[model samples]
Target: MDIDRRLKQLEDSIDENVIDVYDSNYLNIPIKLAYYEIDKYSELVRELNRIRYACKTYEEKELLIKDYIKIYLSSRKMYLRILRNLNNGAVKILYPDNLDEDILYRALKNFKKFDRGKPLNENLNTFMKVKLKQNIQDSNQELFKLKHYPAEYINTFKTYIGSKVLRYRNDLVIYKDAFISETEPHIYSVYFNEKTAEDTKNALLNILAYLNGHPSFYFTENYNFNRKLSELYDQFDLLDMLRLRKKFFFESKEYKEPIFLELPVLKQRCVLKIQITK
Candidate 1:
């Protein structure tokens, strides 16, 4: 699919003069903070594209794509944080000047009805007004402290966050496709060893079962013990191996609370060498 070519095309489209546009808008402090975050994210995207283009092997490219996915997820979280803060700041600014709680709550009700698609109910409106008043009071106390920053400094920091958000979204799709193209053929063949394939398959099925609200089986790992019932022992050993593998997957922040079918066989606790997933 010429993924490198697409990446280069996307990289080239990033506007260098986005900050100047933000400066014209005369946005408040929260939006300005968002702009600065966008600048940092853009720089990261540029560097990631550079490294991605340099990859020579399929494995290297796949690893790079995985790293890009991590970066994309993190960037999305950062963007959402900025947006939330900006929304909170907006609510503070739009809050009623009058100190009367009843008056402010009424005003907020009207504001929410017009601004949000689903207006906050009466109970939530009451809570929001209380919180908004507190935030506004806090902002007033801190406003003077922000005056020390020069106009030039703020302008320099007015970077565009939207462009980077779009770029990362595009990059994720492209890189994900590239990763699949590179790895799909060899995923079961080259990646899965005969000794581990059965256990790995069972572990994945167990995880799927849990997701589907079904009970899964667990196996115990017996390292040194040998028994006449070879098949039964082998099944138990596979379960333990699956348990160990599940532990490693759980260590990744991407997979939360990965469920395993079998528990580890505890005899003498020994450390298992955990390999980083590519």
Candidate 2:
């Protein structure tokens, strides 16, 4: 693709009215493109300085400068191709339908923010965190409606064990656990569960189905519970695990049993009967 032409197209797609000071929409070009442009310009400046330093004669310097200009332009086009390749890979995963306006801007912004120069999987994990936060916020109402289980049970369980399983739309069960303090809930676990050990895995299957079908469905790559549930789903071993009453401890420590401790909860306190003799 022609880099110059693509840049022109991107510029033309910007909505002037939406480009305000408060929001990032003012950035008519993708953030990645901006970075690329900056890098290319910097390279050009350095090459020009190098030519000036090397050539003593004006004519020789002119020739070198012209040659460097041509080289820079060629390299700029190559840089665009590189950007296109990176953008293409990101689009393949994100699957944004439109690249004309806000969607394009957001897509580029998201990719730029999440695309740490790392392995694809690592970049994907970063992207998922952003998407997950958005999904949770956007679908908050839908999720709240799915919480059919009594609030008493939810509250009590959360207080004691820092976990709550709520029924969602009768067909789905959502499990969320807070690994942090009970007073300040920070959910580290979120996934669907079967109603019973022998029950058909309809709820989880439905969620997977939903996610598969809905490209826009919010996702988090590093969701611990989701990963575990997905593994179980793949193996069809959720029922077996449930039947075995398998317990997972996110944190564990070995300590001596309390029998050796002198303090006992049930032991009565004895008061000395010696009256103060004045």
Candidate 3:
């Protein structure tokens, strides 16, 4: 694994094209390597600057910088490992003769756990899980807590409420660290403390399911689709939150109890709990 070899590959990469890779032909094999760079340095530097500017002492920077270096080195090693696999013919590219076969082959090769493979309760690789978990931990949270959105998103109506709100694939997002409290019984919280977005979404779906299942709990949406939510939340959030399936709790016809001074609906108990399992 010489630097010269990678440089040479870079030169040869110009010839690689999707038209050639996807065409019907004889046994033509295309070996492509796209490096996925894992970057933590910028975030680390930001932490360092924050600590240097504000922290009473700069002793924290040493430990944090050291950890960042370790992570950077580990990322380099993984890239090398992936390269080694490609060099050793362990990782396969597309065959113009049979394009889909290699995809199945690669999936079978990378298969680790038997998962349902849905986004809700979706699985992440070890490194990806670690990366995501690091982000959550770095947000100055303990192992777990019922999270709340930042004070900026202070709308009583439809809104996303998560410390780390990820609008990953679509409009609807995972919410946390937020509760509108009128009474203990009338508290609907957007809460999260999960390792993966899938699990968080699964928890959300479960909450939705529970609410939908209860005969006493009637789920109603605002008839007006024209009026959008605040500009604070994304256009997707404003749109998705109003989507009947994603409307967990919002300003509906629930006139009896209100979230704001005179808001219509009562923010019901979202009651998302986080527990650590061995």
Best by TM-score: 1
Per-residue lDDT, model 3, residue 103, is: 45
Residue-wise C-alpha lDDT for candidate 2, range 1-278, written one tens digit per residue: 23345445544553322211123443543443322232333544465566555654434443443343343444444434433443444322322223344444465663556433565444543444354344334334333432433221122111111122222323332433111112223321222122222122234333332322211112245467655554544543222332234234224343323222122111125422211111
TM-score of 1: 0.24
lDDT of 3 by residue, 150-268 (tens): 21122122322221232122223234422222212332333222222444434664444333331111112542321232222223321233244434335655433212222111133
- Model 1 segments more than 4 A misplaced: 1-37, 90-278
lDDT of 1 by residue, 1-278 (tens): 34355445544553322222123323342243222343544555567667755655445544554444444444444434434544454322222223243433344453333223433233333344444344444434333322432111111111111101111111211111111011222111112212223455455334433322222232224422222333343344333444556655556567334444333221215433322233
Model 2 clash pairs? none
Candidate 2 contains a number of clashing pairs equal to 0
Candidate 3, superposed: residue stretches over 4 Å from native: 1-35, 39-56, 93-278
Model 3 error, position 272 (Å): 69
TM-score of 2: 0.19
lDDT of each: 0.34, 0.34, 0.32
Q: How much is the lDDT of residue 150 in candidate 2?
A: 21
